[model samples]
Target: MRTILFAALSAAVSTSALAQAEDPNLWLEDIEGQRAIAQVKQWNAATEASLTTMPGFEERRARALKLLNDPNQIATPDEVMGDLVANHWVDADHKRGLWRVSPLSAYLAGKPVWRTLIDVDALGKAEGKSWVWHGANCLPPEYQRCLVSLSPGGSDADVVREFDLAAGKFVEGGFTVPESKNSVTWADRDTLLVAMAEGEGTVTRSGYARIVKEWKRGTPWSAATKVAEASESDIGISPFAVMDGDIRRVAISRNVGFYAARVSMRAPDGHWVELPIPETAIFDAVVSGQAIARLVESLGQLKPGSVVAFDIAQMLSGQKPEPALVMEPTKSQAIEEVAATDNVLWVKALDDVSGKLFALRRQPDGSWSSKAMPLLDHSTVHIAGTADKQDIAFAAVEGMLSPTTLMSVDSTGKAATIQALPAQFDASKFSVDQRFATSKDGTRVPYFLVRRKGDSRPTGALIHAYGGFRAAQTPTYLTAQPYRSGPLGLFWVEQGGAFVLANIRGGGEYGPAWHQAALREKRQNSFDDLEAVARDLIRTGVARKDGVAISGRSNGGVLVGAAMTQHPELYSAVIAGSPLLDMKRYSHLLAGASWVDEYGDPDKPGDWAFLSNYSPYQNVRPGVRYPPTFFYLSTKDDRVHPGHARKMAARLSADGNRIYFHEYMEGGHSVGADRSEDAMRAALLWAFLTKEIGSGAD
Candidate 1:
């Protein structure tokens, strides 16, 4: 199964061969090899022993677990399934989480009667597998029949099983696809569109499905008809369906690169009609017969920051549809989200790092009109869910200090609070402020600073950032772990330390221009921006120069690793989780080849020249004194290989630098499989931070 998926990867390039020949720690890249597993287990034991004995470890763990398992935590709606709304719930009772549904009418009336559809913990117990819920793709109209995805060991590769909602169980011998990093879309009642690792030449070099097939019910997997096929070098290809009142179009999306895609709609004559969309633009969902797209570069009359739409009917008939302007943001703004609900389009935009929501509708004159929806000012707003046939949508709003509140918005832009979470942490004693830090190149970067009110003394600070990817860093209330924006916020701030969220370059905080400024060759700007934030904190008296710590995960892991190696004295400690460290061998790792557009191809000499400078695995000097670092990883993380953290930790330890390494057995890329594990990781992190820099409770 794995061989067919990664067969094409080994033939890639000359840079990998050279790097492998030079690196002595390549043995740790063997992921499941006996020797590598033994090393990881030993390191995990030592790290746990060292961190668990820190001051207030058990107390902090218990407190974190309590907040994480709080029964009153907000239950954010996952999807609008006909008359019922689905949600994946986690708590002390349901540790593995539960895929359940509540009546939509009752949910809107503030009295939801939930019914359990899938108890993940029970299912795992019965099957003796570490199953993680990966959501469902239910057929539209009735939403009774669905394709449920469950990932074993919480990895991205998941098994798709056809489920019967009315029967409350998996269909006996129904449509089922084996585990792989794949996609299954509902084409109709008896037919489905799937893209999975089937056989040799079917999977891309990036370990994704290169071919999309149409599979009919009661047919063998071999009998599926080919819908579309992308190049083996491209990222991958997947099929999706767009359904409005009378508009239903099934399209295949060919991901040419990490930041680019080519979309083609299937015509009634069984031919693919390609859309004239630029690769840089994102092909969003079609709503009310309009195929919407967000531009990353200027397209004809549409600006880089504009949202454009095309008539799906015109495109299907082999006619080039005139681009219709949906919404255009200012230089200070970025389009955060664009969701559709049949007749209504819900857009969430960020202005100066603060969120604002708008409800857009297609006027009778073939143009779009938008109305500003009232929400919490200076807070983060996200589209929680949108009904398939209704004109209403759900928005989750929260801030650095404010608890999260779920709001319901109607077609006319009227908003109402559906449910509000009670304060889990004492925000009254703390204050939130937005500040700007100037980078080395004089670029103004924005960040959110949270600290105790009236406390001006220098204290230990934790600065978190993800400077790669166009993902924007927004503010959220100090909530539970697993949530990216404000993970462990309460745990850190309650210790009397200031919590800082640095909105550095290489992010969509401003727009495409901001992210493009830090692309591959100019990636140093992101690290410089991070360093500037640390200096700004010290200069503003918010933190002691020697008491500042940097934390990031995944792409941010790259940031943390780069920061510590590039400027050892700037940060007191580092928390790097599930990172990509060996830039030279990154493309050869699982799913790493797909991210070449974001980080650049290490195979190319020109790309490697710039990559070699910041690549943490290559840049770490043996005698250079570095800050104490905590490196966490998951053996099941197929996206960003565990070898990254493993090799980096081994190298740092061999060099006599303080390194704490922990590799979780499950949890894929997230590092925490469930709430219990999330709480434990948070506790361990805070314990390590408290040891490195005094917990500012003095």
Candidate 2:
């Protein structure tokens, strides 16, 4: 009977071939799916109608995109490093910051070596020029050399110019190609393997989806020969080594689903052999000689969070393959980090409830060790590891306060502190605590509370969360300092205020199980979880409901919109940033199709039944007393369309609700006007929140 029910659901929700080919949400074919599409169309029409005549709206948006695409506006290597150091590591002892855009620089003998960079900022702002850095092979090397991709500033062309880092001069042996290229890895001193997107007309129908193209180290810039072409949905390179001579094996995914297959290259004619996995659904895979490790999901199980291992040599050599489930699917064992070394594959697994590191180890014969790393008592753990499998680092440990400590455990079992914040912000007076509350179904949810010590006043509190996409809302020192130093100090704590980080169910904080529990038809779980956090804060007397303001970006924006409609009396103000409010048309919208895995397909009937019930745009009825809200979006948001925000604001405004809409003409998906622009926006958000939530006046 259960099987029959699942089959019925699957059939009803399955997408059409044409839809699947054009839209990522092809799996959602039920009645709810149709409604979702209809709602999106309605929202788009409303948004276009409202903004068509707005003075400079179109121009501003175009200007923003141009700025983003302008090479001069891009951050230099030094600027990128400084930003990372400033925002990521706030500790007084360490000098390193969180590495963004560029992955961790490759290190040899305890020194920095090579690094890669993309021209896009963390907020998806275009840097204009893309580049990579290669350093001396010497011990404790000097990284004074760089190869920069330089095209005419605003032209959408691909050109690379090699620059001598020390002399600040461009070398004559530079190259240019027709297609933009990235993910360049040095095979030898003279050979490069890069990921390229070529022959682009419409990527969905284009023959070149994503391919690995090789380049000779000293060769002039010319058309690249495709090493491998990926299917439309499947993308990602296998974690393999180029160290042992040739490119031994490559991992490729044929479908958008989470499954990967290995293609190995052997000598004696150099033919590529493909080993297919019939039963496993893998998202990522890494190969280390004879051993292969992969992140696998159980068939038909929404929350099969596990990592499996196989003997690569045995599989490729046509021997009886010994497939072992390296990491078993645990409700609590959420895989946070995984990497491959010469002989060992390292895995970092976390337990959901305590935000604690459960285990870190190398696969096969390596020992599994467990330690409770001291995290900021209220911050979520965000872990990042090196590409070469030598170091493992984590940011935003609870209780540290001011800045995050970049602590790395080396291959020799030695833990060293690499980087931290400079001594600018004081960390002595703050305190954070974790609290839990019971949801509507009696499910216990957790949230983080942060405030200054020695304050007992009924301060204003800002409760924030992003309860979708299995994206965890972890604690970090970046945004907290602004609040802590300003309104947070003057209003929340000094003037008596508080800050809350809600760990709602839709987030991966609790693992894939936590996310699956809150998906599709059960989407209400996220709302309930968030409400539970709010109630817990109120019950604890941390802040009254009327003094609380809720803020979230992207999918979290959807949460804010839904909350305002469902329980308007809970929050005094709502700040929805780049939200997808018109859920009915989310799949049909930009980048909306990619999110069907998180949110059920709206075109399908069964999905529609559940989606329409809580879709914030659909739920907004006439004559309801809604809380004052702020809507912010970007005109160049190629990911989540700005229409979501525009339409929501129009409907609310027409209905006589107080809604402040600020559409950034540029800045891509982030809507950050610039560094200075972001500062002003932050100030506005604080001021608005303070005024609405009754924070201490300046």
Candidate 3:
């Protein structure tokens, strides 16, 4: 039976892939595969009458299908870009407002520009439109703003907009160039470092790129010249600068394990000097005087086990100084964030087991003193943190039951509230708890479980997990609170339902080490961690296996997909949003090549063997009893190709599984159609969850 089912699904997928061949892009092919899969699943379902259906399932599914198909539900390219900027940033200023960028465009006098701006105040309240601000640097003065103005409508060309806060309006100053392919950072008001693709290759194969050229402020549009190039096999140019008294030294980083090259002014001429640091996937670095501090993940290693501060100042002066290991790895702790000022090295140690934050300061004598800071234990989760010599500011999200607050701690050991949500949000009835589940490896993963206070009915549960990319899934006090509160009147809480956030291994919650445990070759560790969490909940009688539902987006979508395929018995329903199902082709897809360091290059012989072991799309078996699932993808998602979700759903549906597929034509990577449309999507999702997980509206 399983063989028969598999054959049918494969046949459908092949037909769909062929239909989509009109678009040569791999994305079109994936979409076609999805259509075929859906057809197969539907045919199979027609033959099976034993599949259970929830009350109002057909009606709710119809409504969802209609909302997804409605033209008004789709977001324009501009709206999609705005959502991307808003959710991508963790800094205080970036999180507080709604951000929008014009579609990609070019200015004739200026360089190809993408108008990137943010309105500092509009979030959550507005449907589609948020607060708006033109080109301006949010950071303090002396920082250069690399602004791009997108041409009206979606265009390939853009006018690079350079704005000096000191002078105001967008100026025609600076060199012109094609649209950027990588992130651009500003160094001072005059120089800009942009990432340009110099080469390409297959998804799992290696490639090359150069970081050459520095666009100096006031320089003519045509004068851009090569400043540096990445070595062969290295694909990125990370631009950084260090300020020392009156001089500024520019640094360029390259390779899989980012090695540093320092360019400093030496009287008549400046020369480039390479710094010595072990080969590792360096995320970021800070250079000051003779000291170079970096956050590095050792090559082929999971966690950034060492925080090294090397004295390259003496090296620049023709002397060699030994590098100091400022912070060494502990059993379960890894460096989360680090900064150096004066002579002290301030580091944040993320304790994996407790999901707690620890502050460690290296004194002038090089001794480390560590203290545990109060966990921002509200419904609002911690998004990002910034630190300097005198103080540190961390942004956190409280749930819809609580206001999002930005808190700070000064050198004086005094903690102060810097900012709070401006809109009135009620947080009286909800409570949040951070708990741990033991994974198969004996690794305890932390999770934040939230529900209404005094609601102990042991009702259904919604378990969410995103354990990839070393991204931390913190708490947020937003619409989730209201949704959990029985807003649709489904009343999961009233039914005694609870929400569980599984902090599986592949996340930053436990610092880099936690992420390393689940990356690439050890990818199965994440799945094991997630499965353990589900079992723990069941074993503890907190929630029954049949009463639970799972949801995730992007990498999290991969998590859900894996769960559905591998352990369908654990969940009654699954929602995979904007998921990357075809791991085999992920790296070759849009912007996927850049993530090789995270997911491993699929092209390599060794890596391919490991990646294929869990490639969700390739591993889907025929005739397997999978849970009912709702799949969503956006047509405008230029990031993770929507074909993953579309094809996966189609395949499952065609295989006779209860599946619902919704494709939003214009929502980009984040699947919300528009402002109002997004809210409606949220409503539909909640509605689907309640119908699937909640008991009748008693």
Candidate 4:
């Protein structure tokens, strides 16, 4: 996952004013440095000692672990190939998880007779590598030969090895892509379109593949043929292929930056043809000679947020561009995801914050008509899987207080609940409310409040805001897995505390315009939105000003870091996890350079002028009375450099702030490498929250 890198300083200033000397803690950037590791150990010991001294720390850890390792946890539903249902699950029994499968019949019957395809735990022990299951891509039609990816620890970079599903084993001497930030796509059973690091000079400055190569079966890595290459200014080029029935199309997306790309398709003649699509539009699917896409900017008559298609045949013939709109979402709506199912175009969208599904089918006139797929109210509806060339799709629906229910929708828009999760906790006693907080700019930002029913003035509140990356924050049981967060927050919700999820700006709540509202220099608006939500909660008496705790991971961590510094009086505690706090130096760190589009290029003096205004690391002052903050990051987090948190915590400590730091050895950009690690982290979070806010269990 890409972490958002933006934080705030109170005054407007230039990067020239905040030089490297101001951040003397830069030495901590040496992730594995002996001195840095020693300080991390010292800080971890102090934090664990203090928080563990709080009431219910041990019990909380035990309960959190129990729920995390629950034997009856829902197996996340995934479609292996259309004919079979599969899931990658991790629990106490399978620490490293299992890539297991079941027949479609058995899966739809609710008792999937799961057969393990890959025992990750066993494989890791045998290989002596903490192999994290990255993902897999199987060949089309037959879908037997697979390219399985495994990451060491939990880094974004992974190793891909070809596996034979029918034989249930790794293909001996088969196709393999060694560990790197590589992408391997099946061009055919015997050939692969690979984008990987060739050597020290082959990777982009952003630490991704700079060249696209083709690797055929039985060919040595040194003998692979180069297909395409991108400039150092670009992140990289990735190979993409689509197999729509007998029709197959292969292409590469040259990602010039984080939000921009130029796509070129390999025509039947084997020549690359550039499509005249917008640089920021997302390529969805190709069907009936039409190139389908979702636009990021208005294209002629078609507006942004419109799912449209143009004649691929016309483009190839160099004819004047003519486009057809498939779907257009309203200002309050955003297309969350899109898929093509044989004869139907599946669109799962969000209205306000509730999920609504839609299907577009071709009309006799060659145009498309859309119909709503009736879904549950106040619930999140996401496409779980779509059948191949079949007008059938699986949708998962869940709410803040509801367990997920996997629903199947056929071509006729008929829906059926195939699997419904049993409630993980007793949510019967809790109530959920969708409220709006008017920001300083007078924009109404939506947020969900989950709290105990009746006479519940929350003793404490956990307010969360992920206000960047255009990622939508939705309603679901706070289960971080199963596509999400649950019983863990139930610990606080049941204790007369409220859990608040703020749908602030710079998110997909209101589509592209909402996200664009806080881009670059305007990022302070997102912080304003979050502060408004906290103030609203206190004004409504849902939580005390001093009893409200804020938590954000990644970009959300950036939010917390800014909030704690700018409005420390609003929150009593701040939890920054896998955060990007030092805005000025972010681009100089690992993979941080790629995110210059999201957070602005600090090296450029113009971008740095605004960046210096809110950089949390530079904003830390000795005189300020800040909240006790807990900072944590993964040493293996290559995507968002751990140095962001390390340097920030070190500087804050030097400035007389009550700060605690912990760096785990594994689990890249995530809370943990395994279940127990996740549970322990949760326990520690709750411990600190309780220590600051007095448990809130009136």
Candidate 5:
């Protein structure tokens, strides 16, 4: 498991060897070592005792949990199983959540009568496993059977089970795959295309399934027919099934790397045909007779980031196919989503980080034409559900000033709001604005400001960002723990505090070009972009100089850690969660090697030179006047080892820096399985920020 470490360590230079020799906190990376656990307990107890007793901790925790567990909260529409809409929900009464369905008629009545398909809590308790629902994919036409995915303890790997949706039970003697980053799709009612971790040495260097197998009804996976295999140097293969009414196609996607794929589709007479598509293209589906794709690279005359369509029949038969442009994005625009309905292909684009939708349809002369679909201004429209049999598709609309509203649309591009959630916060007192900050390289970075509606500058500001992995920070109404953009607005903005979302380089806000510019060696641009945003807010007097704080989690956590270590005087407080601080050893951690495609292989000489200089753990000095910092992580964060947070906090404290830290007992990468735990974390985060960013500097 972590074979990349051997290769990376073999290339370690004298400087890296010396850095490790001098590092005293290496013992913290032992993960489950007894001494490490003891240190974690000491830090957890110390931080919780003070943070939990804050002035508004109780109120904030109660409010966040209330919203999370409220039964009235919008039941986000997922799939169209039958004449009913399916959803997965968790509330105060149901901790593990309920996978339920509501008839379209009942749903339209504004009081959906939900019928429980499976009570996950009950299922988990009976099985004695902490089962977190990943998702389900059912057989088409008659979606009576489904392949259900459940994560144990909320890691990336998940156990898959075949279930009888109509019977509302796990299918006896049906397909059941043991957890190891499993991927299973329905090839038919009695057959499945699966790629999973099976025999010894069967996983990729990135710790994913290397083999694709075809499993038939009533046969054990061990006895299944082998279909394909991904090389040890490649990131594992995944099975893709696309349905176009009566025509169904099954393709095995061999991921050459994180960003490239070579797709081979099963042909008419049970043979495989390699579609000559750009490796960076996403095979959406066969719309009519054409195979449509959202390209990360240009295909023929189609520009990168544009949706294009090509003849599927010709390509499947190993013939050259011409590409026709579906939707081309302007420089300020970015492709958000590409989805297919029964009769049309829908492309969702972000114009200046706002939302817009377009429909691509085939003309009478065999060419394609696109029309701007009517959608509400200033809101994001997410394709929620679609069926090949029905022309109507579902989308969820949300914005900074709006709660999520489920919308239904027909083939004519007409949309209607089927369900709407009442605003959670009082929008009358707050206003939303977008501003751009020029970075050190003269790159203009966008940031969203959500604060009180007044001419006066905000007394305090909390700037948040995640400028890695090409994950864009878009404005939407959400009350979740991790992506707390909306929660920050609800919890902090309403309290007379300012919230800013920075769209820095290394993100997909502007497009792939924005992200590509900040990858690997040029990763410093992301930090520079973030610093520019903070400086702009303060210089413009929108945020108090002494009352400015920064926060992020995962990759974003590294961003906060870097900012605090590199420029401590600029920030008053820092909240770094489940971060990758020690880049020198990051590749050795769980799932860290997989990200070498995003952040270059540290074993390489060129990559190590830059990574060593940018790593936060190595940069934190004994005399650095760092801001007050709070670090948080789950004891079982298997994705990013909790050691990163542990060692950083320990080193900071050893240097006499004001450090606050908490390590939850369980919860994998997310750090909280239930809202109760999530709310407590949120309370502590807000409390720590409030404590560090005190009265206004003005």
Candidate 6:
């Protein structure tokens, strides 16, 4: 049956003979199939044996472990629940994590008397499940009750259980959602707006909850009242509740596309009222009584990337509220995050790829006043958590050379450091420099370089980028992962190697225009931009011509995959992790349907025309001298199917190309579930890089 299905899928992939070629490794897509698991184990063993045998591999692994297990690292607040700040902490002792909380006042001081609410490792042992902490949605006001989400094996699908925060225990006979990619929001003390995987017709094609029900206390899930439903073709529906001072408003966001959603609020009469706004407009947060939304497309007189505030009272009254612009970024600016406190809206943005924060407040006469937040210069500021009842927020500020420092901020924009992480690496010995590379379209692509001070000679370097999904690659501490953050100083830079962060097109660094430049048929621009950065690194004496490597995961994985296939001569090594390689079959895979808005649908003729051109799997040639590539993927990665890495690796090896494949059994889309696993992967990556490019100083 599986074989017949596989053959049918192959035939339906494309009408063209090239794409109609039968896939020999289709069985690998079965995920949990015995054959697939055996093959993954064999590859894992081979890759581990080969990489771990390298000189200094154990030492590097130990160093990474020490850094990852550092107890002095700041426990950044994940959320503010009433007067307590909640943080999920993971260390050598608590590998899974400890969902703990501390008084905001005590946390603001240097010492925090943390009370562990959920010991994830202990819970996992008690339940005999490898549970990973998803997060907790605590009820506002007193915040005594919370819905705790726990994922088995680190997959996106998780089981939700209600917990009593005051008692630090799971509430008996309380609400519980079965394992699925579900969402549960507290509508009141005894009511919940939940989107769960009940049975057939409950989940969308993208494997998310398509129906949302209002579940009440002491009742079966089936007895819950249906409040909202989205079409199966839609991405999914998520119910969210916002607390506006003393009032609570419930809304359902029907995600029609990845970046598009239609939000409707439940009126007092129990009818859903759709908000009169563009589907592309992001409903950021509700501050006071105003709904804040960030425009992705031009709406009326407001331009794209404009943050606007709308009065909620007018919308609830069946009237279209005129949006007042809170702030509009310049051409060189990009809004990163929009967070709200009780009375203030904090906009974290980037100016020419440098971090800048602003505080906007709605004034009398329906006007808005904005003021730049007093933050450290040349550092990235991320809002850790924001208080709902108080005009207080916490942000973590860090840079390429600076360790992360947690700060508490007031409505007046005054920020005071709460805790600072000790330097994990010798940052004083390194310097960060921003450079520009002219791309094929005459566009200037900005990239950051982290290298030893006073070193100008060509050396081995790694160019990292994620040029999709409007995600901006920002500067972080050395202990940060390079896949998301810009660089890894301890593993690469501290080892006398230069690390390059390519802020190419398709990223939010420069705003929506920057990302749109690399969309659809223009996706090649991201590849061109990446290659230009690699060449620029060589031309500027930052990296040896034959020693540059490129690495990215997921979207960035597609970037490097295209880079190696399109411009193989520019890079010596390529590391693609959990990538989307077979564009022809991506949409048919799990959750791939939701991303068609980002990457064009391959089933469509015109879209496939462009996707096929740069698809690494389809573009592979018999005799081309491609760079040595390493492919790592998680078997539990239900998001970006592991088949992408499997088939790509299989195809490359079949073509007699040098390739290494490692498929981890756990850690759905991420490197691992714990810090130790993350450290091991980092060490393995460094081993491969060093082996390919020769230890830094040439």
The residue-by-residue lDDT of candidate 6 on 1-698, one tens digit each, is 00000000111123355543567667677777798788888878878888899998888788777777889878988887777989999889999999999997788776889999989999999999999998888887888899999989988778899999999999998888988777788888999998876557876766677898898899887799988999988888888887666667888898887888898987787788998877888888888688888898898889999888877778878999888888999998998888887778888899988888787788888788888878888888888777666687788899888888888887787888899887766777889988899999899999888888888778899888899988888877756758622224457877788888889898899888888988888999999999999989888888899999998989888898989998888889998888888887888877787778888999899999999999878888888888889888787777888888887887788778778777778888875777777777887788888878876766
Lowest-sum lDDT 10-residue window in model 3:
1-10
Model 2 alpha-carbon drift over 4 Å, by segment: 1-202, 205-249, 258-296, 299-303, 318-320, 328-333, 353-382, 385-402, 422-425, 454-458, 478-494, 696-698
Scored by TM-score, the top model is 1
126-218: candidate 4 lDDT, tens digit per residue: 999999998778776788999998989987778999999888899999998988877778888999999886656677777677788888888
Order of the predicted models by TM-score, top scorer first: 1, 6, 4, 5, 3, 2
lDDT of predicted model 2? 0.51
| Candidate 2, 502-527: lDDT as tens digits | 87888777666677778777888888
| Model 5 lDDT at residue 642 | 84
lDDT of 4 at 350: 92
Q: Per-residue alpha-carbon lDDT of model 1 for 1-698, expressed as tens digits?
A: 00012111222323366566798778788878799999999988998999999878888778777877889877778888779988899989988898989999988877889999999999999999999998888887788999999999988888899999988999997999998777778888899999987657987878788998899999999899988898988888888877766556788888888888888888887788998878888877788788888899998778897889888778889898789999999889999788888788888999999999998999999888889998888999988888766678899999978888998998886888889989876788999999999999899999999888888888999998998788898987776422432246777777789998899989998888889998889999999999999999999888987899998889998899999999998899998988888898899888888888888899999999999999999899989989999988788888888888998998999989988888888988877788777778888888888888877844
Local accuracy of candidate 3 as per-residue lDDT tens digits, 468-497: 876666554433332221132223443456
Top of the candidates by lDDT = 1
Give the residue spans of candidate 5 off by over 4 A: 1-22, 108-111, 455-458, 478-486, 695-698
- lDDT of model 6 at position 368: 83
| Candidate 4 wrongly placed segments (more than 4 Å) | 1-20, 317-320, 456-458, 481-486
lDDT of 6 at 569: 86
Task: Please provide TM-scores, in order, for all candidate models, with all chains considered together.
Answer: 0.96, 0.69, 0.72, 0.95, 0.94, 0.96
User: lDDT of each model, Cα atoms only?
Assistant: 0.84, 0.51, 0.52, 0.79, 0.78, 0.82
For candidate 4, the lDDT comes to 0.79
Query: Which parts of model 6 have CA positions greater than 4 angstroms off?
Result: 1-21, 484-489
